[model samples]
Target: MKIGYARVSTGLQNLNLQEDSLKKFGCDKIFTDHISGAKSHRPGLESAIEFVRSGDTIVVWRLDRLGRNMEDLIRIVNQLNERGIAFYSLQENISMDKASSTGQLMFHLFAAFAEFERNLILERSAAGREAARARGRFGGRPEKLSNDDLRLIKTLADSGTPIKSIAERWEVSRTTIYRYLGKLN
Candidate 1:
């Protein structure tokens, strides 16, 4: 059996392209998720892994769909291999099965390349951050609330102002208010 898995980073992205490719590849069943690959918990991926048997194969439209990074990809592939299942990536032309030595070598080579690619990205990012720092700039999103806003929130809360009212005045959730206060603790 060839069980397929399809994923998109967000709900706004369509899964049709992946699903169609899987169907065209004659997948017996295809599980899907509309969530970021960085997330560890994916119901569809979990289901597909659990559904496969010793002789079954797992297929994905692309290698990245299986994992967010090389470590994750290698881990999931290793788990499948340990379970006596084959893995295939349609776009990457990677096939790893129990009886194929060439396939095993290729999988390792691909994993090495993936790792190198990740390292390159990290290096580039670090260089870019350093350049920004040299110019007195920083990355990341700016804070939503300023110190003054926080002080006002603290004052209101200390004066017995309702959390809901404070949240409304600050245009934030009560949870956010608690979180900011929690930071001081």
Candidate 2:
């Protein structure tokens, strides 16, 4: 069975080209996503993965259509190969069926490239975060409560204010109030 997967980065782009090629290749079923490949979670891709079985082939219009990066590509293809599935890319003209020596070599190369790409991304991200920290910036979400708010919350708790009442007043959970009070003491 041939299962086709098509993707477009945005809603503005059309899947017509990929769809036509997959259909021309005589795909039994085609799954599509109108979302960015950068997103790790894709419903169509997941569905296609889940739907396929051993001896099934997943066909894509191009290599990039299937993954956000080379690391992601290797992950997906390796997963399929481990399950006795094959992958076919129309534009690249590559078929990986776990039999051909060329296919095996290509896959090993993909693995190496994926590793290099992953490392480069990590290095860049770490450098960017360090630069941000140097400028008095930080990563992660901003705090829900400020230092002043925490002190006030402590004072309120000390004055015999009910936890539930304080929580209701600040639109925060009772656990939050408890946490602040505990930290203050």
lDDT of 1 by residue, 6-76 (tens): 99998789999999999999999999999899899999999999999998999999999998888788888
Tell me each candidate's TM-score. Answer: 0.62, 0.69
Instruction: State the weakest 10-residue window (summed lDDT) of model 1.
Output: 98-107
Error of 1 at 70 (Å): 1.0
Best by TM-score: 2
Local error of candidate 1 at 182, Å? 30
Tell me the TM-score of model 1: 0.62
Candidate 1 scores a C-alpha RMSD against the true structure in Å of 7.8
Looking at model 2, residue 100 earns an lDDT score of 72
